[model samples]
Target: MKWQRFFLLGSVGLVSICILLSTVRNLVSINTNCPLSRVDKTTLQPTWPKNRVTSSNLSLNRDNKVHVIIFTRWKYGSTFTGEILNNNPDFTYFFEPIRREVYKNRKIHRGVFYQDLIPMLHNTLKCEFIDKNYTWWDEENKSLDCRYSKKLQNSILCEKSTIEKRDISAYLSKESRSRMVEEICRSVQHVAIKTVRVPDLKHLKSIVTDDSLNVKVIQLVRDPRGVYLSRKVTSDVCDMELSECDELKNNLNYWKDPPFWLKGRYMLLRYEDLADDPIEMVHIIYDFLGLPVPETVKSWLRINILKMSSSSKSAYSWRTKITYKTMVTVQRYCMDLLLMAGYKPVNSEKDLTNLKIPSIRKFSYPLMPNITFGVAKPNTV
Candidate 1:
């Protein structure tokens, strides 16, 4: 009986020791896998490569592909300006590709933030259309249709015959949809994407720093007072205006002290400048892109400029629509942006309507020599 008791006790002790060892191994494994635990708190983080690749340092030619990011906020004439580039046959244009992703993930996904949207742009520039986050369809759970983009219609999946068959009976496969967009993207030599989702230029650090991509950033800004008046009326007008001004402020602060990579890779263009003289702006934009102005683009300008001229929304229509009270409210929220962008503040209704009182102060935008292009008000900067 004593011998049996000893053996039983020994077996029980061995099993307990084994279980304790297994739990400790799992704990160590979990710690090792944790990203925070992997980094040593005492050690400094590694820095990004500081090799500057500005336009001056690197020549843009027809031979080398270029990526252009038209970074601006809503109601800033980005769509109109981007349309100018889209008219060029040599360039493949994406109109607000990140809009859906931003809209879908904003409320539900707490983990996704403003900076997280950069990867979508990066992948688009590289012609990688297969994003796990992107539902392969522009609209979620909608009918498989190519009506969203005329560009996609040119792809195989959305070709007239293919689309007809699918419309009648078959649905577009996920693989086919992705392939369609990818093919269109890869077939082009140059890619341009206009995004209002990226509010801060600093979020583009990863994209600009990448040596593989030849990116040119055009920071398009407009008068905040005008923007407020022109924007689609929303319940939270003041909040929206505040967000837009904050973004402009962030861009200006970034450019004031830009990193080496961004020194010659960025240019600032005012919406007023583009609206007032589009042909000249097109010439400047094409020169910066290192491409000659195609006749197609010239034709597009000639026709569209006339249409815009006839439109009710003249560049300064805000002068008439904005009441003195609204102007004051916008001015109060966006004083810094107005000051930076060279917009004159209006104190009274008379000041608001007086065409003689120019909204934008006279400023020369020298594309080269400086990044801000002399737009920054001296006192504000």
Candidate 2:
């Protein structure tokens, strides 16, 4: 009887060990076999991949719902772009859900940081916002705070002003609000997120390549000179340096040769062009994403354009204030990116007078032509 008891105990222990080993294997596989290779510091190879999506164990889903990330740099009119999607009744937009995480944990090791960040993004995309607790970094106290909870609630669950007039709170308690958010998340056909927190293109691999999500990326870029002028006027510190510009140029070059499978997964849009022709640009973006232009988005754009016109603010208005010295400095630092992006340099304020924001009409695939924008055709080989 004692021998039988010992054998049963040993069997239980073996089963536990096997379970632990399987879990470890799954975790290891998630990181080790990812398509985006780790950053090789010695060779300066970027941790982000602009080439191809690596095939992995992630299972793809046949559901046709679309997911989009507006991958952009700081102060590049991302808010305006995000609002375009936000106004669409059919789309659910999340604004910078990972900003606090990225800012507070800047010193964390890159690989581990990405591992945590990628999953956080996946959860956000899945509308698992309320189930998890997140703390935003308070710059003044240098501590994590839940001050953004209300903002998250408004951005994700409900816009207070929109619902307040209807006395939503009389019936919708906190618990019910969460349930409402979950149902909205599940029923929405499209999910859109705008973020500047992502450090590299490689960080997007798991989400974009996952077969379960029909993810698309819109890389928003601006004239570096315009970016510099805007930052200078607002006293905003420039996060991008000359070295980063060089890296960006190299990344663009790499993207010029992306694998065939990645052809229609992403596209580039210029903030300047979008500003010049908001309606046309939005229409093109809708076409690229395989979405029709909803009436709500049209009304929002019309109202927005009128407001901007009445206020005397335009995308290139800052160019007049940029000093020649500042122009030279900006040109020197951003020359590679300017040339690669087909932006012409302005030597003087007078040069800004006749400068035209390039109009992009249709994008062609494979080579990603200098044309405005491109999306993959459904049945293309």
Candidate 3:
């Protein structure tokens, strides 16, 4: 009887542990309130390469491909998109430490904190920053609106109280920006750098005292309707929202402006296109970035299904409530943005069924469909 009771207790203990473990897993997977807790990276950390394949023992040579900069907005698959690119063994991913710090601290004087970084932007691959974080209030056009009022409470700012004192956009000169980006691509490496921010590109252009930055741009667009809808639900706008973004031009014409990074080389990726045929869309981007394609990327390509979940939520987000009032407030501002972006104002869920734009990735053949483009470009370097 003693032995049987011990065995029974052991079985119960094991079952209890299993149940506890299962609950913990659910909390990690389903909980969005805590983002970091849910971000499980399966990639093992490895020491970054310091040299080119045929160059010095530690420094990479000039055979590297284009340094990919992720100009992304919030809630538009930027995270997952970065993940897909990084997981490709040939590509390396670097997050923007300066931007991350700004995000957490709410403000950064580029004069002090970013001085060390400006010089380091050259001859590197895979550098990225969140574009939404690059903006500040633009008072000239009376465009400093209420989208980011929540952050004002904690930000530390004053003309003299800060570190960098130059005009915010003047510091990052266009010539310097272009040179750094060009050098990064020319380096004999296949690393990717992504920066997501809605800096006053127009303002940035004006203040860019130097006009010679080789900053080829890849302007990404999402449906203004969807963008506004997402902003409404989250009560937050990404860097590209016209109201919050100073000097942002609408339509393809934005690319032709003096400050605009010009070229077929200066590409445009639509968010809807990316979601629809991510692999093919990415291939076009890969080609544009001057990088070779990856096998894993070929496997992950799909468009229609990729967007179903977000589309469903966009359709019925009103019925759902993380905080109903908060969502409503966000919606009001979003409506204003929609009108500004030339999107039809949508309140009722019934109207959403008509939007037909696909993500860039969706435009490509489904599931990395066999395409002639995969014929790797000859060593362009």
Candidate 4:
């Protein structure tokens, strides 16, 4: 009986030891498998999910195909800028995909916060243009004004058969339309979206940083005075209030020290420079994306640039029209941004013509959090 008791105790001790060893092994495995271990040893935690799609993943999946967003403020020559991409056969442009939704919902204003729009734009980049996500201004009339507008219907990716059949049966069910749109989206080599509703760069953080989509942002900035004057001169004559100008200035300031995630992903282009040399500027942008300058785009530039130049004597056409008091207000409001963008203040219309469009300096990105700045120069197309 004593021998049997001793044997039982030994067996229990051995079982406990095995269990202890197994636990140690699991702890070590967990430490080894941690994703953070591969990154720099810092306490900084990731705000986004670990499995989020990244540029690396995009390269592997799409053979380096790109997704471009022409992010611009309202009336900042965004239409013309978007045209550059629209003319490219390789690109399928979506113009203001968020406009109708915002128009339909009063709560969804132009300056609506970033967090609210991130999820919507994320799905949009993935070619998920569901009916539920979008609200049209004329839903009662069954107007296709939002996504299925005449211009977008004629885009390179749209099926001619679908566009031509316009009758009772032609109006496909929501599911059928969604499937058709998704098919076109997936078939395209590249997708370009242009928007005037984005209030700031931060609103695009998720889409631009997302690995699933190869996203690039071309931030088109026009002179504040030009934007203000144009707004004032419009038929509605809505003067851009000081608050609006201040908000714009704040947005520009935010980009000067962009978040670390945005490094090498953001590019700035002045409206004046683009207006002055549209062909060269367009080439530069295409080169930055490592894409060939499409012949169609070059042809479009040649025709449009001539028209733009002939209409105005100088790029700063607002200088002559703006009152002295208003000019002073604009100068004061946009002083910091103007200096950062290398624009000088103009006291008279003569100064506007004499002002040479400055060559934009190459934006530099830092290698690490506090390491040396590296030159990720824009390619001259």
lDDT of 2 at 333: 81
Rank candidates by lDDT, best first. Answer: 1, 2, 4, 3
Tens-place lDDT per residue, model 2, 312-368, is 244666566667666676677877787766566675556655445431223332223
Global lDDT of each candidate:
0.69, 0.61, 0.40, 0.60
Query: Of models 2 and 3, which has the larger TM-score?
Result: 2
Q: Quick one: ranking by TM-score, best first?
A: 1, 4, 2, 3
lDDT of candidate 1 at residue 39, scale 0 to 100: 15
The per-prediction CA RMSD against the true structure, in angstroms, equals: 22.9, 19.9, 18.4, 16.5
Using Cα atoms with residue i matched to residue i, what is each candidate's TM-score against the true structure? 0.74, 0.65, 0.44, 0.67
For residues 206-251, write the lDDT of model 1, one tens digit per residue.
Answer: 8877788888888888888777777646567788778778878878
State the lDDT at 363 in candidate 2: 33
The better candidate by lDDT, 3 or 4, is: 4
What lDDT tens digits, residue by residue, belong to model 3 across residues 1-381? 999999999999999999999999998656533311111124312121111122221121124443445555555545555655665666545444235345545466644544434433322333332222222222222222122111111222111224655333234444443343334333334555445544433322321222322233454555444545565544344333545433233433443332223322345455555554344455555545545556555444322233533543453343342243433443455554333333344444433333443211122221111122221111211
| Model 1 per-residue lDDT at 100 | 71
Candidate number with the higher lDDT (1 or 2):
1
List model 4 lDDT by residue over 1-381, tens digit each.
999999999999999999999999999877655542221115322121122233432333346687888878887888778878878777766777776655656564455544665666666668786664453222243444334233346533233345564333134555665555566666668887777776667777778778777777777777777877766643322234455555666655545665766555556777776766555466566644656667777666545654656433444766667776677777776676666655666666455444463323333321111113432333332
lDDT minimum window of 10 residues, candidate 2 = 52-61
